[model samples]
Target chain A: MSENRVPEEIQENAAHEAAKLGIGTDEWVAQHEERTARKKGLKGVPQFIDESIPAWARWVVLLAAAFAFGAFVDNQYLLRIGVNLGLFVMLSYGLNIVMGYAGLLDLGYVAFYGIGAYGYALMSSEQLGHHWSTWLSVLIIIIGTALLGYIVSLPARRLFGDYLAIVTLFFGQVFVQLVLASDNITFPWADDYVDITAGANGIPGIDPFSFFGHKFLNIRDYYWLLLVLVALLTITISRINRTRIGRAWRTIREDALAAESMGVMVNRLKTMAFVTGAAIAGLAGAIFAAMQSAVFVSGFDMPLMTMIYAAVILGGSGSLAGAVMGAIVMSVLPEVLRVTNYSEILFLAVLVLTLAAVGKSVKRFTINIVSIALIGFAVKILLGFASIKITPTEEWVVGPVSRALSHWMYVPLDRVLWGNCAFVILIVLIAYFTTTTPRIKTILLPIIGYLGIFLWEVRLVTDVNTTRQLLIGAMLVVLMITRPQGFLGKPRVEVL
Target chain B: MSEKKPLLEISNIDTYYGVIHILQQVNLRVDEGELVCLLGGNACGKSTTLKTILGMVKPKVGKIMFAGEDVTHQNTPARVKLGMAVVPENRRLFGPMTVLENLKIGAYVRGEAAQEDLERVYDLFPKLKERSSQLAGTLSGGEQQMVAVGRALMSHPRLILMDEPSMGLAPKLVEQSFEMIANLHSQGVSMLIVEQNANMALSVADRGYVLQTGRIVLEGEAKELAGHEELRRAYLGR
Candidate 1:
């Protein structure tokens, strides 16, 4: 008490609070220690970063790193990934404005992006026979998108939460439907049909941005362009957040009714947030259009929107830095998954991470890891009695990592049925284990790990896209379960 | 000011939650530089009456006069600008934001002058100043209550509305909170505090209103209300 170290009282009270929450004394203590240590660790690093490195220096470091990556990665496929990642960064920033700052879930945000794409495509495409300059086209697209956003927000902003979500989702569907149906339209008054939207095949031959007679032809150019734009948007958005408007938006998100009482014009500000997010999305769409030199409705569908949402949510909605990290993860995950070696390493790393996080103590963690090793031997011995054919490592091994895995893994030529069954069983076992006693969980974990590996080798390994999708879906689920605030996001305390 | 008119005058207001008629003909008032407590049990529309004054819950029938202006139809922020501030039920501080940020938002409608108000709040609650950087949600119950009250004060309102300031606090902390409320009243800040703890409310209040089942059953000076036999059985547990 004399030293004024306040944790003594708080720690005592935390025990009582934990008991009320139904957590055991030991578990609560451990969690508290971890939380306190994490806070201490975070405090030091952020202080060091802020004090030692100026904001400009940090940006310089980031830009330098981005450029170095661009210069080093020579493969066109890798460059394409860079561009995609940059685009994802932009999209996440756009979505962050509405979802993070305003706390409005605009499911039809993709439509704004689509509007930007089509707006640019129409003015600068061969189909339209009007090749506008890059500056004019982008300006028109942004303004048009902002206008569309303002219009959409007129009705949607008044709708609260779920209702707003539904309206925006319907708007997305409408955009898709209108574009899909607009191939050949018969006017009510006129006889002849007009080819307006170019329909399902999409409007092609869109001109790339030629800035001052300097054309952006290569994937690297688009990648650089997007990176620069992302940097610019990040600065702009952060500045906006520092203003009274930003504080007002956050207040609205915290409690709309409370914010109103605090003298904030809730509805109008929400509308403004929508328009702002829309403008950014539109800019990203314009760049996307120019990069691809084509406009397809397929690129602006639900999955793309989901990917963007996942990035924003994963990074921590209100944090720009979190958004960037999340965007890069969401973008590069599929590309990494495309390669067997990268995906295998990632899966094993993640599994190890999960084990370390959940294991509680070092002794327990060691036991869990050891149990996994023992499970492999036990399964192998059991398989011998069953007379199942275990293929030689030579046949299935693709990379050095898999070659090493071959010694332990149960690889078989005709194992798809068993593999799929193992995957389902693994899920069930994990679920069941959670509900069971600790002893049961400890005993079943090894089997669960083996089953997971079996599923990975047999089913997930053979398919890249599906594996990527599974990993992302799992990532989202894990995020929701473990930490909804996402990486770099502050843990939110939801007040009732 | 202007012959000592009531700072907040809620005249026979009937507030409803979609025909539920949560508050019926509920009349309450707080004169300048006075502390008034509205005491009631659960769902007795004490909070509804406060919300009605704050413009969160519109009255189906009545007049709410603030500084002699009819503010029944005015919006929440407009009322706030006209010097109305609330420490909401459950101390609804912006959970993710720092205590400083929350306090800043309390003076949000005040704009540039908020810094001075913030200093004033800090002066009242030194603990808030010490833990200014800590998130509002992470604070202990007493600390959160302090932040909530401090936030309301940041608006530098002519009249402050408090909703259940002592609900989750320990007995000692509740006493401390009431003392702070009393301290504020002494400093010429008019307040309308709604609470279920009739005993605590009465101890600090200059005037008190007793509400039950959406109606004001009694109203008098604090000393009279404290001695009311019915209030003793129902609330003070005499």
Candidate 2:
């Protein structure tokens, strides 16, 4: 027992060694572990939710809900919106493969969609005196568009970043110009000029999609068709992502040179991405043309391209679920904006949501909202004293939300002019608010809130299109500042 | 050392970036199970030699033979499949991807049957197994270096080309890196390491080649190169 017991000096040296190694006492170690565990518990909640639910289960629930909504909903307008959303979802998925997975900036992606539509239109319609079968036309369009996409991406193979974007953009413009000008063609050996695309008039009388003697007649039919296609696409793309090809594509996106050195064929994979994306877009285009019973070059213009890009970005690039969610939001938003009642409700809801988000504390949020209301009433009274004629509520305000807002907001007789002025001033105030001190920001918050409502009621709501664009722009700016990775994307750490 | 079989042979190769010649008459070789270091100062075309061997940059003249086959005109992926792998400068791990994903990407040519290689990598660097799910970019420099080397190993390459394995690592970690390289060398894995730290590199390497500008200015056994008066005066800071 005496031999087993350590000497005093040896024990002291052991303690010194433990201290030198930064190994704390048992209690201290336990306390440190507890603190770290608490922190991890807080962070792990969201991640736990993510991991607990399998991706397949979530997708099943989502698709089932979508299917139920489309199947039962009798309203044609709503069904049309659903169908259009499905179309946009398909486009986003296609773009996600190219720009998200492979990181190629194919600005001319919509051109593939246009080509598919036109190809289907020509093959199925009497435009070129051709009435190809529905399945055959769609198959041909998909294959032809994929080939075109491969050819288009050939020149862009050596390009990167902005240069790649420029080349693809040029291709997009070329597609548009070719479609526009090809309406009239007089060959040296021809007797009469040929009408191909029919110019600005577009190609009309395109056949509706029919399979196994079942014609897709109603908006609901198209909606169901799109939903099926989207579901299939989702499964296929996600499967591809989990496979070697998808990993190769992502590696190329991350670092092409590294991917190449790692034995991933960068150029061939890039071409494959382009072709797959183009083929998907082509399929969507053919369906879209059939649904609309026409194909217009204008329909596949910059605005549509912008919407698809915005949807992909908003949803979170490189995420399949994000693309679908973004497509739903972008597609439904404009339609919601078209209706005055829905638009008013949306505007106020967003305003309140923004306030709640910015003012994390309930007290701060309350103070901001109260101040905004007080300022609005005070401004109305001041305008009354200044003899500025306020418009009567019954004359202009239609919606219940607008009617409620009319009491506080001082809508002038010439609201359009007043709104225009407020918009410019609001822009300046927002710019100033971002750069100023916190105290100044508190003061500016109420003012900005009041002005935003003022602009919405007085000017913006009247111009639905502009308002939608402005709102989307503002949303993107805020999202970029707060969460650049978007709703579903993982936060990436770039080495440089 | 007897009857040496060169796994990678770059003979009188000249490479250019547009009109600017980057590597001139760069003749180098790595035999099976040998550790060779390519030593040079900054911008002395050390990296270009690695790139040319990997077929990222096509040499204007001469040939590159990998595993005794002509790979001069072959693209990077082809060369990689021919048993070449590079631990690139700055440890270019896919920042957003996990350590395991990066390793899997290294096995891109070999396909999904790299589970055995993956386990081997983890066995070599057990700490990497713990951090396999963590992003490669978020790892410490030493850890990242391990992942980079592990990633190269996942390819099961006959010749691993390391571009500055010691760069951006602490002094202690630099010693550890060389030790790891020495360990790998002993395991019969061939390597062609490009380095600016002549001392550490030459210590682990069996033989070394010194490049000046774009040409191989000096080539000898590691012991001789370390003791050379001119080498000591220039790179060794004697």
Candidate 3:
């Protein structure tokens, strides 16, 4: 039937039928709108985009901009970096829902990301013997991820915060190990399950995406696709935040007992945030799968988790803008560092020192002067030495020029001196910054108040050689010392 | 008002938090439109009994019959739906929510009665309407108490449970709250109140129960309880 031929009574009937079935009118309208939009071949129909331009035209304009910029850069390599940044933005926004808004710590968020990538890979790759459309796989990826999120949260959510984070992290590790150890569960084309994941070797022959019979092989097209997804994700999260359910989530975050007292279904809202966050991660993962069209164990490793957590923290934890900005920084900074040819250890040292020098109590100009001087000093020392030799890995080399410069660089004494200087500068910066900034001082003040309070925590994690132990330990100490609630968390007082 | 059944009946209710038994064998009853106070000193089982009745704490034993329904094991939200509301001790307002939002949430289970009951609440507390958009936490103690009382009134409950309405208030505000309570009692809203201020509670209540530890020590007409030598000496500082 034509759209016009559908009678008003019939439409009204469709809307009201759910009410007749004992559902609330408001809930009925929401569900009916969702169903009707799906049947009518419209996506986000009720959603308002700018009236001046159709959404499709806006997307075209964005795609054109990305392509033009990519071409101007004169490097497919830089274009690839842009694409990776776009994907991280998507993941970070998704993570923001759990960590930022809902205030749940999900350590193994990458499990859903992995599920999406693998789901798309299995369906669309040549290894599967037949290719499913990327769009179809994307849909499947969302469903798979949402289901996984819901299931994982069912048991995991019984525990709160640190306990939940550990469980999720364990879940991710177990999932990865299962794929590595088992062969029968994987497709027949793979010699082993480990081979599909490539345990270490990684999977190849992953096909580029073709959605709605249109192929988008280049980074430029992927950037456009991801930008649109990111926009939609933002809209979804913003709407949820404003909705009654979102208000419920915030109430639960503030005080679970109080929220329960106020007649909110606290457990339900917590579950929703976890599942929704996971689902969004899955969506990003599907796009990621299509972007790379390849798989490997290292692709979804511990570093991915670190980057996500860093993004959440660096951005204002509960703020939407914070999460988005955090993701963008986390994604782009590594590439920027790669281009600049800076050492990760050196970068970390500088960051820590910079953070210290800019402490809350310090004058603003002092922070600026100290930060600029430190940067200048590091650059001068590196340029002056010009003859040190050290090699970690190709990724860690910082840049091609840095690798070349390292050949003639100093070996023992100079290297030690540089390291020591950086350390000393970092300590000075920390001391200066802490004394200056009350926020930084507040963080350290707790530890000062109870000297060596975290010594037991440090000793407990000494067994785990992984960098994760340090990250977890530092996060715990920082959280406990600075603001027990969180860095930017709101202080909530109990009524009785 | 009804000879057939009391508006609320509490029979031998015991409440515990872990191993600490807070309320033991607590019994109270309110006939339709009757104003009653569960009176006690600090650390007494009055608040615990009120919480038990509101389903904030489930009774370890005994049934809570509200409007002839067994609400012994029902949750707070469920109890709220059955025309039961509480003005909890210490003015348990949603700090971030605007005063209006706090009132709106109180009527969450009110369903269709929201608009009418909201109007009634506004009429009852004009100060709330004036500062409806203000965050409840920012309000002064008396104003917060007004929000708390207005929120309970929005439910248009058959039985309103109040726990220490006069606590932490200045003398003038405490008198004002008690005066408001008297007005609400006269408006035919049956209520079960718990209070440290025995004289004020007894002055308004038609009947009163004196609880010590977890058990009711005295039960009588409000006038009789008000003049009792033991009660006056112990609680009223007479």
Candidate 4:
């Protein structure tokens, strides 16, 4: 709105130009809005909101919010967790471009993150690797991540919808598996002579980020570091989203055929999204490695994928706030799970059940319920059979279906009979309640759901088994049936 | 007609989409300030020829000469910058944008002094100024078409190409749209209009070409084309 204000100097200058052009003030304004609307579409909610918040003013709010969150949480450990969450916010924002704006799902986002992490780790660590200054390492990490992103994008740009996703996921999984399987390569930065990535023990005493000879070793310093990165990431993404390139991405997402018909180069836009998202993930990885003082293969777990996606979905796909919220829940949930007698599985179960019970009467609530139930079921089944021993599991990659079925069916089939009954009962209850005054019947649903989740979680299920994977498979089916968009993600509309 | 030399010459243009060859050896020419109409029924390659001229698609083999320069290999933006403008089929106005934004993007290929063209376009279509802030998509079909035309005009193009501007229009709007085209002609802008309504197109056209399948089967002065027995029987529903 303040853009309405024209200083006298500008008005005078404008008047002189107008006299030469022989055009009136009203005409100029009308044409400006017309041009802007064409450049920015009607569904452009982000830019509309962004224009209202001035840059300098926003920074002050960001700093205040960060410090307040740090001070109020009071625990240095939690604050450290918060810093990690911020790092993920940077990562998710990057991922949002490829997966959100460009409609390209990239599962190998973390591989770029690893590149940056290892770029810094190998250069900065003094154990089995050569030592370099933190500043130089930081530069190397950024360049390395960008290069990795570009390399991956060459193939990724050609893919779209689900194929791109599967390939990227495969790419990321292969990288992690290689690191885990190859002990020779990982130990270069290890303290021991035979350790690369310290063989799961992980390298330690990698120097904290030292720029211009000033080291940032404390949580407070790390918090500032994260804030700076998050802000830069947000600004860069926001600007890119508003520019001509961003318009091309949206056009492609909306209708690729129509976009190409309009002479927009579709391949170029897709490549930009893939590369940019990878770069962001890489940046986050570098910062994370610096904070943790080491890189570990175990850090890039499959469960971390679920958590990051959950955050992205919960916050709102393509929305920065959604990414931030998603990262926060993911980074902190495990820690919170550790503190309570209720395991992380139970925490998620309870959270989901409560949401579903409360959401039952709401139209479109069933979608949320289904996804939550799936997540809960996943956690429940995975946690229940940690004690069951497995024999003769291969070290390298297994075929997907076999691997999936093996993971879910590992424990004694009878042990999960109770879980099957409970899951069936929940489904029956959901189905039965939908027909009549289900709202009134399930008035106490939230309490009942959380109690069910709590009862299962309090038993401290630890070792992951086949039960979790089955739950996840069930969850995917439920998602396709109920809320194809998943909870909090915008349902995709197909307009021919 | 002054018998001025043709500024744009098209020869033996063959355009294909996969197995469907849309334009076959389509030869056409336009002298300076002449309004030409490529008239046909729906799906008769009138639109495809316009697109080929705009460089939206490459011809299998043809020479497109603009001011004696070969531009068949040029891209859309390059062609546009060379004083070419198109009111695309279906009037693909940027929907969520204001009427003004629709016009602005039309002149997007134009450099910094685009405001001059913007004013010229608005003066040409006063209705656009009235609903300047209104989202182009929400506008009535007729109004949207006006925005599309105004947008093309914003580029200050020497030659304007339009495709099916009369599609899905009420009779009155269609009449007004043709009148506007005639008015544009009076302003010295050369035009190549592709229209399914042969009657309306020939009314404003200095000359007309009748296309069937992908090739031009008849070419003559507008009056002669209008009076032709075969064309009238085939297209004008005589």
Q: Pick the candidate with the highest TM-score.
A: 2
Comparing 2 and 3 on TM-score, the stronger one: 2
Candidate 4 lDDT by residue in tens digits, B31-108: 889999999887889878987888877898889998668998987667777777777777776554456655655554
Compared with the true structure, the alpha-carbon lDDT of candidate 4 equals 0.68
For model 1, the stretches where C-alpha displacement exceeds 4 angstroms are A1-34, A39-60, A71-74, A155-158, A352-395, A479-482, A494-496, B227-235
Find the candidate with the highest DockQ and give its number.
1
Give interface RMSD, every candidate, in order: 6.8, 8.7, 16.2, 10.9
Q: What are the Cα lDDT values of the candidates?
A: 0.83, 0.87, 0.67, 0.68
Per-residue alpha-carbon lDDT of model 4 for A205-225, expressed as tens digits?
A: 777887877888787778878
What are the per-residue Cα lDDT tens digits for candidate 2 across A65-110? 8989897999988888888999999999999999999999899999
What's the TM-score, to 2 decimals, of chain B in model 4? 0.96
Q: List the residue pairs that clash in candidate 2.
A: none
Task: Point out the worst 10-residue segment of candidate 4 chain B by lDDT.
Answer: B104-113
- Candidate 1 displacement at residue A146 in angstroms: 1.9
Model 4 lDDT, residue B47, Cα? 77
CAPRI verdict (incorrect, acceptable, medium, high) for model 4: incorrect
Q: Which numbered prediction scores highest in lDDT against the true structure?
A: 2
- Alpha-carbon RMSD, candidate 3: 15.7
Worst 10 residues of 3 chain B by lDDT: B105-114
Sort every candidate by lDDT, greatest first: 2, 1, 4, 3
Clashing pairs in 1: none
